[model samples]
Target chain A: MRIAFTSVGTNWDAQIDPRFGRTAFLVLFNEETAQLEAVDNSGVQADAHGAGTAMAQRIYELHPDVLITGNGPGDTASKALKNLHMRIYVEAHNMSLKEAYEKYKKQELTAL
Target chain B: MTNSGIFKLAIASGKGGTGKTLLSTNLADYLARKQAVLLADLDVEEPNDALFFHAENKVITPQYKMIPDWQSDRCTLCGDCTRQCKFHAVIRLGEFITVFNELCHSCYACSDLCPEQALPMKPYRMGETRHQILNGLQLIESRLDVGQEQAVPLIHATQKYICELESKPAIQILDCPPGTSCPVVAAVDGADLVLLVTEPTPFGLNDLKLAVETMRQIDKAFAVVINRQGMGDDAVENWCKSENITVAARIPYDRQLAEQYAAAKLAWCDNTALEEALEELALFIQQKQVQYA
Candidate 1:
């Protein structure tokens, strides 16, 4: 299962970005393969109205089973994710990407 | 010298509710007595210029723009149109490409660059133009449909309709939208002169500076008109004095004018002081036409 975390930077040590849509980087961690990858989310800045929805579309394209971020997705994005049967957890803000992922693995983080 | 050319004057205010429509309606009404006048309300979002006059024989024309419409039967999820769209309007989701009409700018870049020729351009109605003829004045008001974000295209369509007129009016007063956005620029562009309507407050002064900067960058001649003069401080007056920008006219804060305006009545024409001010404004515009000509 791939878990996506909204991150401020491309690395694992980077803090989790509070904004889901305008997050700088989306760090994807595969629990099965123990593999980690970071995808740049710079294009979301160009979206004026539906940034959250567009970012959700990008996340859907990545095939992430779960999304972890500081803030919940917007109304439109949340609806899209619901249709895709993706679970979202909102917590672990200001924490590093690696710490957030480890806490999620240990079932320590709150599911929102 | 008799000025035979059409004088296009655009009334714009950087801040909303600064009496742009009030000034434009009265100015057009006063100017129509001597020569033919066309009052084009380019504030497509919420146009209220028609309220001042008893507009008769109204004609509504729909404004459309060609937007990319997809054909699902092409049988290929190649993602060519998605790659070509710069606005992110096209989204590819599990062998299906969805087009968001609101996000599309009607640039046709994706349709033109489509590899399989699946995307076709279709006419999307943006807004409607209402043409009305008053006693001696012609009012062309553009109304953008609700939930529509694109206003510049509708403004352009209204201008095109005006240009196609067989007998072009001697004076065209465009009531522009507030702020120095794309819609304001579209309405004020190619005008003979821009009359910036502003109040005497801090917000009005700050927005006026922005409007002035936009006008200067576009290389258009502009003059300031201070409305509700006594309600606020003299910041606008002092700024205009220091900048050497011409103060074309001033309308004082009158309770009667406000009440009449709320009732959709032309009370300015009845008041001696307001009528004289509007006439002087028309005279000033005539002098400017001769000077620019």
Candidate 2:
């Protein structure tokens, strides 16, 4: 399963960004292959409106099964993700991306 | 065709409550005696020019814009519309595609590029323009819907309405909205002349600088009209002098004018000085019209 984590930087050591839509980077962790990748989120940051929805679309395009972030997605994005059958989890505030992914693996984060 | 044979003067200000409406209404009132005048309150968000006039007859016309309406029966969620929309107004979630009208800029990129032809353009009422006849002056103002985000369409509609008038007025005074945003640009652009009304305070000066930059960028001919002259320092005047922009008129700070304005009364009714200043402004515009012509 592909899990996405909103991060402050491109690396696994980078802190988890609290904002889902305006985060600097979205780090994708492939559980089956044990490979991690980062996608820059500057395009979503520059959006005038519906940043959450735009971010959700970007994530949906990646075919992520789960989204792990410090904060929950906005109303519009939540509706879109729910329709896409994607589960979202909120945790890892002030923690690194790796730490957040470990907590997600342990089922310690709150589902939103 | 460029001239339109009618003098178009736009009153603009970067900051709100800098006496733009006051100057516009008074100038319209003064100019009506010499020529047929049309006062177009382009500040659709908060139109207040109509408040100053005792309108005898009023006609309201609804303004509409084309927005994308999706058709689910078309049997395809190709995501063509979703990918084409730069505004993020359209979103495809699994089997469903949702359209957010509020974020839509009406660019029609989605509907135009839709391969499935599921998206169709529909007219959405954004605002209403009121054509009012007051004593001798004609008032054309637009009122935006409470939650509507699109204002430029209404403003353009008002301008088109004026052009289609049976008898075009000699002078069309556009009372523009505050700030140097898209709405303000729509109001002031293509005008024969733009009068930037500003106060003489720090906030006023800062915003005036921005307004001036906007006007210059658009290559529009503009002049400054300073309100409450004595309230602030000589910085504004000095800056204008340095910039080589003319200070066309200066309305002094007066308690009676403020009181009358608060009561929704014309300040020039009891004040001859203000009335004379407005008259001079009218003459100045006339001279500019001739000079530009």
Most accurate candidate by DockQ = 2
Give candidate 2 regions above 4 Å deviation.
A1-3, A30-35, A45-50, A63-66, A70-82, A85-93, A98-112, B1-3
Compose the digit string of candidate 1's lDDT tens values, residues B1-293: 12358789999988899999889988888888887899999999999999988866999999997788888897387887777676667767666677777778888888888877788989998889999987779999999999888888888889989988887787899999999989999999778899999999999999999999999999889999998889989999999999999999998888889898899987777777678779779889989888877
Docking quality band of candidate 2, CAPRI definitions: acceptable
Q: Weakest 10 consecutive residues, lDDT, candidate 2 chain B?
A: B1-10
TM-score of 2: 0.89
List, for all models, the DockQ compared with the true complex. 0.36, 0.48
How far in Å is the alpha carbon of A28 misplaced in model 1?
Answer: 0.9
Lowest-lDDT window of 10 residues in candidate 2 chain A? A75-84
lDDT of 1 at B175: 97
Whole-structure CA lDDT of model 1: 0.85
lDDT scores of the candidates, listed in order = 0.85, 0.86
